[model samples]
Target: MDADRISKLPDHVIHHILSFLPTIDAVWTSLLSRHWRRMWYYVPTLEFSQFGNKDVEIFYNFVDDCLKHRMMGMHHNTMSVITRFNLNTVYRGRRSKVKLDRWLSFIAQPHLQKLVLNMFEYEPVRRRHYCLPEVVLNLASLTVLKLVFVELEACYPVSLPSLEYLYLGHVQMEDEILHTLLLGCPSLEELYIKDCDKLKSLRVSSSCLQFLDLSGNWETFTIKVEAINLQSFAFSNTAWKKPCSCRFDLASCKKIENLSLHGVSFYPDEDFASFISGLPLLESLALDQCDLIDIRNQHLKFLDVKTVRYKDRDQANWDEEDWDKVDWDEVDWDRIEISIDAPNLDSFKCYTKNLLVRFLMNSPNLSETFIHVGYCAETETRRREREREWIIVLIDVLFLVLLVELLMFPQVFRRNCRSPLPNVNKLKVEMGGYDEDGVRDALLWLAPSAETISIELEPF
Candidate 1:
C-alpha cells in the first residue's frame, strides 16, 4: 500500500543522508531495494571506525576492498567528489602504514575539503609514535585537518593553502616541523595543539589567526605568537609548580576579547595587573588554579576565579618521580591574598576552600554574585581578620564560616555594610552548628530590606 515516498528522493539528497552513516552501513543499505543497490558507491563522505572488530586483518581488508570499489566506480564514471573522510584505527606494523598511505594518497584530491585521521593505539611496553605517510606532504584543497598520535615522516614542510582549521593532539612533531607547517597554512584561522610532550619551542605567526588553545605540561619552553587579529586565547596546565616554565610575549594580540588560563604561574617580570590593564577591549576573564596577587581593570564586565590551597589537593596519584621535583617551601601556598578592583563588573563568582578575594569598591551594576566557601576554621579566620577589613567583602561572601566570624560580633557587619544591600530581593540561608537567633540577627544586619528570606537550618 505504501509507495516508498522517501526512497523517491533525488540522488544527491539520498547521498547527503547516507553521509552521516558509516560507510559499511551505507553499503549495506544496498539490500533495502533495487533502487538503493548502487547508491553508496557515489556518496561523497566515508567514515570507517575499527572499534568492535577483533580481527585486524579482516578490518584492513574491508577498508581496502571498500576503497577499491570506490576507485572502480570512479573509473566507470559513476562516483562523484568526496569532500570529507574519517578513518579511526590502529597502526600495528609496516602493513598498516602501507594501507594508510594508500588510503590517504587516494583521497588527497583537490575536492577533498576535510580529512580526519585518528589512530590511537594503547600499548604499555614502550609507547611509540607512528610516522605520517608521504602523501600528506601536499593537500592544497583541505580546509580542515585533524591528526592524533601521528608524527611527520620527516622535517620537511607541507602545503595546505586552503586550510583554515587544524588540530594536532598527542602528535609527535619537532618544533621546526611544527613552525614550518604553520607557515605553510596561510589561511589558518583556528589552531589547537595539546599533550604533545616532545615540543619545546612554540612559534605561531599568523596574521589571520583568531583562536589558539594550547594545553600541556610544558616544563620549559619559549612561546611566541604574532596574531594581530586574535580574539580569544586559552592555555592550561597541571598545578603545583612553584614557577611557570614557559615565558610568554603576547604583545602582538591586541584585539583579544576573551581569555582563560589554568595552572599558570606569573613570574617576577610578568606583571598580572599590567597585563590585565593592557587588554583594553577585554570583557570576560576566567582563572582556575592560578596565582592571584592583584588585578585592576576598568572595562571588565565578568570575572570568575577558582583557586586551590596546598591542603586541599590530593597527591595520591601523582607520579613519585614528578613529586620529588617540587619544592614545598618555595612559597607559602596557604597564603592566598588576592585583590580585585573592577568598577563596571556585572557578574562575579569565587569558589575556594581557603582564599580571600578583596574588592576595593562595591560592584554597583552587579546583577549576580555567587560565593561558595568551605573549610575555613580558626587559623584561616584569624589570618583573614588580622589581614583584611574582612567587612568590605562580607556583602559578597555569604559562606557560613565567614558569616559566623563577622556575625559573632554583629557590630562589625553593621558598620561595614552600614546600609543593607538594597538590591537584594530574594535571599536564602542555610544554617548549621550556629544559634538561630544569631543567624536571624546577621540576616537583618546584612539584607534587612530583602523582600523574601528563606531559611533552612537545624536548631542549635
Candidate 2:
C-alpha cells in the first residue's frame, strides 16, 4: 500500500492507533496531512513533556496551538475527553510560570479526569510555584488528582463529588487546607501523602476510605485517623518519627480486614494497644521495624512482627560499665500480657524466641507457628554443619574399633561381641578366635545378606 493511501484510514481507525502512542507523538502526527491534522484533537489523552534547553516560549506555543485546534474541532455535545494530562517541565525563570498557567488554563476542560503536574527548577532567587486554577479543581468528573511541587493556598475548597483517589507529593499546604480539600471530596476512597512538608496533622473521618498511605516529613505531628470502612493502611519513611496515637472506632465496618504498620521507630504508647484490641474483625496484622510496647490482638487470624538488626558482630557487645550506669528495674513490664481470642487463628510469627510457647499451646485453633530469634549465638545453618561433622567422626571411629577387636581374636570377637547377628541361615559361622580385622572381614563378607542392618553408636 502507498504511504498516502495508508494514511487515509478512517478517523476511528486512526484514533484507535493513536491511543497507543504518547500524546506528544500523537499531536506531532497532525503535520502529516489534512486528514491527520485534526486526528490528535479527538485523542482521549494528552501529555506535555519539555526536554532539553528548548525555550519555554516554544513549548507553550506548541501546547496552546494544540489545545485551540482540539477545542475548535470538538463538537459541543460530543464531550471530547482528555482522560489524563501529565506535565513534566523544568522552568528556567519567571517567564515559564506564566506560560505554564496559560497552558493549564487552556487544557483545564470539564472532561479532564486525571491530572498530574510536576515541576523542578534550579533557580534559587526566582521562587517558582504553580497554583492550580479553580476551574481544574471544580471538575465533577475528576477521579484521580495528583499535585507535586505546587503550593495550594487557602481558598474556598472546590467540591469534587466524584473524586475517588487523591495524591499529594511534595505539595506545600497547611493541615487545615488539606483537611478542607479532603472534606470536599465526599467519595474519596484512597489518599496518598508523600513528602508533604507542610502537612502536620491529618484529621479524617471518612466512611468510604479503604486504602491510605502517609510517608515522609521529620516534623512531629499527631495523626487522627478514624475510617469506619478502612481495609488497609500503610505508612513508610525514616522521617516519620513522631509518636502517633491512632484511634480506630469504626466498629460498624464488617469488611475491615488487613492492617499493616511499617517504618515506625518510636514505641507506641499504652493507648495504642487498646485501639488495636477494639478491631473486632481484623484478619491480618503486620508490624515491621516498629518499636511496639504492647501488642495483644485476639481477633486477627494471622500476625507477623519483625525487628531490625545490625550486621556487625562487634557492635552487638555491651561493656559492664554501660550496664551499670542504667537502672533496669525502673522499666515497666507489669502492663505486658499475652492474650488473644482468635478462635480461627491459623498462623503466627514473632521475632522474640523467648515468647512463651505456652501461648501457642493454649490457643485452641492455631495450626502453624514461626519463631525467629534475631541473629542467634549460632545460626541453624552452622549448627547443622557441626552435627554432620560429629556424625562422620563417630562412624569412622566405630569402624576402626571393630577392626582392632576382630584382629585380636576373630572367633572370640565374633561370638562374645554379641553384635546381634542377622537371622540368615548361611551366616551360622562358628564363634571362634577372631581379631578385629577378621570380624570386619566377616561382617563385610555377609554384607550381601544384610538387607537391614542396625548399629548402636552410643548408649541411651
**What clash count goes with each model?**
0, 18
Q: What Cα-based lDDT does every candidate model obtain?
A: 0.74, 0.62
- For lDDT, the strongest prediction is 1
Candidate 1: where is the Cα deviation over 4 Å? 122-125, 239-243, 311-333, 355-364, 374-393, 396-442, 445-460
- Per-residue CA lDDT of model 1 for 208-299, tens digit only, reads 89999988777565678899998888888753353245566688888888888777776667888888877777788898877754677788
Q: Clash pairs of candidate 1?
A: none
RMSD of candidate 2 to the truth, in angstroms, is 14.1
Quote each prediction's TM-score. Answer: 0.78, 0.66
For 198-294, candidate 2 gives per-residue lDDT tens digits of 6666787687888887777543545667777788776665432332333333444455677776655443443656556667677887776554534
Q: After superposition, how far is residue 125 of candidate 2 from its true place, in Å?
A: 9.6
